[model samples]
Target: MTQQSLVSRRLSSRATRTFALVSVLFVTPFIATSSANAQVYTRAFGYASTEPGAFPTDGVLNDPATEDGALPARLRRTTVALTTTEAPGTIIIDTGNTALYYVLGGGRAIRYGVGVGREGFTWSGVQTISHKAEWPDWHPPAQMIKRQPYLPRFMAGGPGNPLGARAMYLGASEYRIHGTNDPSTIGKFVSSGCIRLTNEDVTDLFNRVNVGTKVVVLPKNGPHIAARELGPAAAEISVRPGLTPARPAVVTQRAGRQAMNIPVSSAQY
Candidate 1:
C-alpha cells in the first residue's frame, strides 16, 4: 500500500472511533431519563411517601372541588366486588392491600384507599365500631407524643387537623378508623396503628354505620383482590412529597348555629 494511503486509512479509523464514542454519550442520558420516567409512570403499588408541597388550596376537608386536586382519583372512593363471606354493614380492612371495603351485599362493596399501620404497629382481628364521631377531636396518646414530639398534644377538630372529617373508635384499642388531612398517605403503610381514609370517605362511612357495626380487620396474608387490579391508569392524582397541610372545609356561622360542610383533618388513635 502507498504511504499516503496508509496514513489516510489510520485517520479514517480514528474518525470512526470518535464518532462512535460521541453517539454513545448522547444516547446514554436519554435512555436513563426514559427508564426513570417509565418507573414513575408504571408504578402500580403503594408509595413510600407523598410528593412534597402537595396540598389543597383552601385547606378544607372533602371539598369536592378541592379533593380532586389533592388526592389521586384511583385512591379515592371506589366500588369493587366482595368475594368474602362477611355479612352486609361489616367494615373490612385489608391492611396488606391498604384498602377498606364496606360490604354492600350482592357481591358488591364500596372500597376506599387507606393508609395502614407501619411495620411493628400493625394488627388484625375482629373489632366493633363501638363509637363514631364527626369532626372528632384528637388527643395524641403519651406514647405517640414521645415518638413524634412535633405532634400536638391535643388537636381540635376542624380543617387542618390530622384526623380528617370523622372517626370511629375500634373497640377499646388505641386504634381508630379515621380520616387524614394527608390524602397522599392513602395506599401506603405509614400510620401509627390506625386505618385512615379521606375525610369525605370517612364521613360517608360514618353516616352509614352505627355504633355497633361489625369491623373485621384481615391479617397481613389476608385474602385481597384489589391491589392486583389497581394500576397507574387508575391513579390519576400524582403523589407529591412533603407534608402540606390539608385544606379546610367551608363553614358558615348562621343564627348562632354552625352548619359545616363535610371535611376533616386528623384523628388520634
Candidate 2:
C-alpha cells in the first residue's frame, strides 16, 4: 500500500473517533436532562399509571381557578398574635372556629381556615404527623365507604381529588391534614374527619411542616385555648371569664389502645 494512502486511512480513523466523542458529549446531557425531568414529574404529580381514571386527561387539573377559588375574607390565611405553650412547628386545629394555626413561636402564628368534620364526626386529640406525600392517592376507608356508598372506592390524586395538592398523615389513624378541591369548604363543617384547607394554603403549610410535627385538634365544644388571640398583656385569659385556663388532655399510647383524659371521637376521611 502507498504511504499516502496509509496516512489518509489514519486521518479517516481519527475523524471517526472525534465525531463519536462529539456525539457523546452533546447527547449525554440531553439524556441526563430528560431523566431529571421525569424524576421531577413523578415527584410533583406521582407515578403515571395505565389504569383507567388513574389520571384524568380532561384538562381539569390545569384550571387553577376552579380548583382554588377565592376564600372568604374572614377565612383567608393571615398572621395572628397567638399565645401557646406549644413549640414553633406545632399545628393546632380549632374545630369550633374552623381554623388551623401553625404556631410560629414568640406568641405568634400563621392561621389558615380549615374544614372540619361534621357534627357527629367531630374529634379531638394530639397526634404527630407520620407521613407526607405530594398528590397522594386516596383509598376510602371501610367506615367512610359505608357512610357514603356513592363515593368512589379509590381516587388518584389531582386537582379533582378531595385530597388535593398535598397530604400529611396524622399518626396511625386514617385522618390527614390535606388540601381540598372545594375551597368553599375551608370554613365549614363538612369533612368526614380529616382536616382540610385550600390547596394554596395546604401547600404553604405542607412546605413549612415536616414528618413528626405535633398536632393538636381542639374539640368542637371544648375550651378554645389555642384559638383565641389574647394580646401579649392578657395572655392568661381563660375560655370564659373568671375561669382557669383549661389544658388539652395529653394522649397516651398503649399496646393496641390509645387513651386520653378528654372524651375523644375518631373518624376517617
Assess each prediction's global lDDT (C-alpha) against the native: 0.64, 0.66
Q: Highest lDDT, which number?
A: 2
Which regions of candidate 1 fall more than 4 Å away from where they truly are? 1-60, 68-74, 226-269
Q: After superposition, how far is residue 180 of candidate 1 from its true place, in Å?
A: 1.1
TM-score of each: 0.61, 0.61
Instruction: Please provide, for model 2 over 1-269, each residue's C-alpha lDDT reduced to its tens digit, 9 standing for 90 to 100.
Output: 69999999999999999999999999999988876765553333222222233333323333334434466655666677888889999999988989898887888787888888876877888999989887776665666546555445556666456677778988878788987655656787777678988666677788788898999999899877544443322232212221111122111122222111112244321
RMSD vs true structure, all candidates: 13.6, 15.5
- Candidate 1 local lDDT, 24-73, one digit each (tens): 99999998886665445223222211222232334455474465466676
Which candidate gets the maximum TM-score versus the true structure? 1
The segments of candidate 2 whose C-alpha lies over 4 angstroms from its true place after superposition are: 1-69, 225-269
